[model samples]
Target: MTRTIARLALAAAGLALLPGLAQAQKNAPHNDIAAQAEQVFRSSFRADNPKYWMTRLDQDEAMRLCSQYRDNPPPKMRAQIEKAQMATIRYPVEGKLIGDWKEGEKLAAVGTGGHIGFIQPDPPGRLRGGNCYACHQLAKKEVAYGTIGPSLQHFGKLRGNSDEIIKYTYDKIYNSNAFSACTNMPRFGLHSWLTPEQISHIVAFLVDPESPVNKD
Candidate 1:
């Protein structure tokens, strides 16, 4: 009986090895694997309503390329990816990319919006916040803050208010990925996560002399 049991275990291990050997012999294409994964994903989540959101699962040109290379493409690939992304960014047509710092401070702290799958959603008057403090240390007064990114306690003081500096700051806040490909920072303007006016305010928050970010 013990001999029979050992034979059965050996047979099971051989069965597993057969599949591994077969897979090694017949390698699946990357696109085929991705398509299979997407099918599995769609089957799991296709029941939900809001068909518009479902379309988001589809990848765009940049997203497809980014995923194809797992966000660490070669230097040449990185530059090509950045150039594709940079073409999508549109600067403010008015040529004035600054707004009220006070309002900007309030918006940066609110942190609400982008919630779905709810029955009776939030009221119409909800204000979305940047929650920049969640990933960055903004001011000296804010005792509790995250440090995923660099601190901006004295952003303006450290980087004086020059037109070029102001433009760079505004553009950085608009689409961080344009500057650094695959950056963890969200593309606030690219995704319409924040409006141009709101972004300008964020720029002001970082560049304005009177803002808390620059005050101390």
Candidate 2:
């Protein structure tokens, strides 16, 4: 009878401690939670090129700040972040910021690259693409487009192809955070996911009068 009572007391003690453990987890700092999540994410993935995947996990200053602000940084901080990101933008050497819209159109439809799974690294020579259609609707004929971002249909018609507009568009694509801090748009150029020439092509797709983005 004494042994049974002892076991019952121990069970009660363990049950009493459960709430405190739960509360501790609930009160853990955001960084600690993120660390735990990162650990789990890293353990879940198996990559032959671990360094490629591991480097992706490391966040830059802008990404870190965006996370801290929950993608809504205050006005002053927003300006600071924008300025910092703007400084990172590198224009082309030839002083031309436009490329073939045809290439851009192809790139927009492609949603492959940086993919890792049980299959590991992608096949060789599979070029990375902007995958722009995943977010913004550029071409009016595209039946499938995500609404996470505003529709960019008639983009060139709305915004005239002035030098200022062209530069603004180029910079925005190079590092979207340069224009809007904590934006969901990926910093394509900042991360080298796309080269300056490739970004220029995307800009052309958006601003060129003959591009599908502006076509009726």
Candidate 3:
């Protein structure tokens, strides 16, 4: 009878622990995989630009939060992220939010910058490009465009060229996460990938009616 009673108590204890065990199993695999993947990535690449490449591995608060939520943070967290990112945007000193659409078009199309491979770094004097077409359909003439981002074919036509719209466009390009937290778009201005002047031009490319992006 004692043996049977002990067995019953053991079963009840196991049942009580099931919830904790299940929760641990659910969480541990994701962490384990992430750690393993990070290790592999760190080991795979030789430090071409040790300072630059190593910094990429380090996650800031925004990056860490985004990863924690899998790019879909809760509304409160999203708002917090947006608020923080919005504070980082820097506008041009000349107070011009728009520039030449032609220059903008060139910036959008040219996609070479900050490339690192094996032991090689990007050659100096190579102007950086937004490579916008890789993720967005801008000009109608570009036959090959990626669909990762929304089609911007009629961006200017639809939104029109208002002061508010222009500012929003420039800010968005500068720090996309400022508007939409955990967005896939790169923070061009925040990272210095594109200068404020370059971003202003790109804004013109999207908002200029004469630009091929808005033309049918």
Candidate 4:
């Protein structure tokens, strides 16, 4: 009689759990939660921040698609993004793809003036830089470097400073997604953060034989 009662109790417990299990299965996350999370994320930032800083949060087409696809879009969508971004690349009026590598060295090393700060945002008209060392190993002497992107220490040494190399390096700096969609590399020239001439200097930094990236 006790065994029969215990079996009945177990059956009752199982029956009670069925509704909760069903609800759990049906409550999978979707748009509502995503919207809420995004709202919470936005609220974390200061609303009084400068327009330039606030605007950075707004997503462009590529950025929107990248987030939707989790930064791993299929080939068709990836190609579409690259094509659209490539159209935005501009060349200097003088059509120079290479500039003074010396200047590029300065830009690549300086990581200040980022726009992410709120209470103490960068002062207006402050100079920004590629902050390349934040993501890439540019020169061998720089022991402290990020590994998010490949080490470019021997970039020019490995890839000769040919016209093709110069053009590719310049375009990549101007708009990295033009070559690799949803890339972590910033679209320096595309967003006017860096001018075409500035990009050309970075190109020289990457492909110039005399640049520390190559020689040192």
- Residue-wise lDDT of candidate 2 within 55-127, one digit each (tens)? 7777887787677668976676677678889999998878789888888898888888877645566776788
Better of 2 and 4 by TM-score: 4
**Deviation of model 2 at 37, angstroms:** 5.3
User: For candidate 2, which ten residues in a row score worst on lDDT?
Assistant: 20-29
lDDT of 1 by residue, 3-108 (tens): 9999999999779646543553254247678878878987876465588767767776556656656766556556655766776666666877878888778777
TM per prediction: 0.78, 0.78, 0.80, 0.79
- Model 4: residues with Cα > 4 Å off, grouped in runs: 1-29, 39-49, 116-118
Q: Residues 84-200, candidate 3, lDDT per residue (tens digit)?
A: 899999999998999999999999998887886565667878888999999999988897888888999989999999999999999999999999999999999999999999999
RMSD of each: 15.8, 15.3, 12.6, 16.5
Q: After TM-score superposition, what is the CA distance of residue 169 in candidate 1 from its true location, in Å?
A: 1.2
Candidate 4 colliding pairs, count: 0
Count of steric clashes across candidates, in order? 1, 0, 0, 0
Error of 4 at 170 (Å): 0.7
TM-score between model 3 and native: 0.80
Model 2 scores a C-alpha lDDT of: 0.83
